[model samples]
Target: MQVFEDWNQKVKKTFNATNPEVVLTVSEAGSLLGLTKDQMKLYVDKNKLTKVPIMRSVHRYLLLKSEIDSIVKTR
Candidate 1:
């Protein structure tokens, strides 16, 4: 699947489509980046994706869609 499509599916599966700009969960981000869970965590640790804290001790990532679109184009 295309990266954007994959990302949308992941988001829907993991966290319902409350909003497109809504922060994606880690799993969704991984799918978007085409990375494994471990790699996704590493990217979080390395600050590749901006981390945003959520309620009840959960966290989410805010990814720039434009930035991702650029990467997709290059690939």
Candidate 2:
């Protein structure tokens, strides 16, 4: 039964396509960059990072995972 459950989980993951582009929320990205969420917001604006805007929300957005990876690599 445990093995079956594990296999089922794997199958579900394979079919799940919720995050096709991979994104990080403000808090998540901020933690990675050692900044507070508000500080991160300012950094995003100052750096002109790509923001994946949420539907009907002007202030909420997600940052591209690829961009964050590149920033990490450079630093």
Candidate 3:
């Protein structure tokens, strides 16, 4: 029954106020790294970056803002 479905699913995707971590799209992250979107994809693979995959989708993901910041400081 619809009532039995998880109430969490009913929540709005835009409602992420509780989550403290920030995420960035590939293009945004690429800009911060001084690399094109395509190059960033390659860099992610070569560096084994953790990709936050989108639900019901492939070939798309988000990167943690903190992780990118650390990399910038180190590299």
TM-score per candidate, in order?
0.47, 0.73, 0.74
Cα misplacement distance, residue 41 of candidate 1 (Å): 1.3
Q: Indicate whether candidate 1 or candidate 2 has the larger TM-score.
A: 2
Clash count, predicted structure 1? 0
Candidate 1: C-alpha lDDT: 0.58
Model 2 poorest ten-residue lDDT run: 7-16
lDDT winner between 2 and 3, please give it.
2
How many collisions between residues are there in candidate 2? 0
Give the clash count for each candidate: 0, 0, 0
Strongest candidate by TM-score: 3
- Model 2 ranges with Cα > 4 A deviation: 1-19
Task: Give the per-residue lDDT digits (tens) of candidate 2, residues 6-55.
Answer: 43233334433466676777777888899998999999999999987665
Q: List lDDT for all candidates, in order.
A: 0.58, 0.75, 0.74
Candidate 1 vs 2: which has more lDDT: 2
List the candidate 3 regions with Cα displacement exceeding 4 Å.
1-18
Model 1, residue pairs in steric clash: none
Q: Per-residue alpha-carbon lDDT of model 3 for 17-73, expressed as tens digits?
A: 545766777777899999999999999999999887766567777787788999999
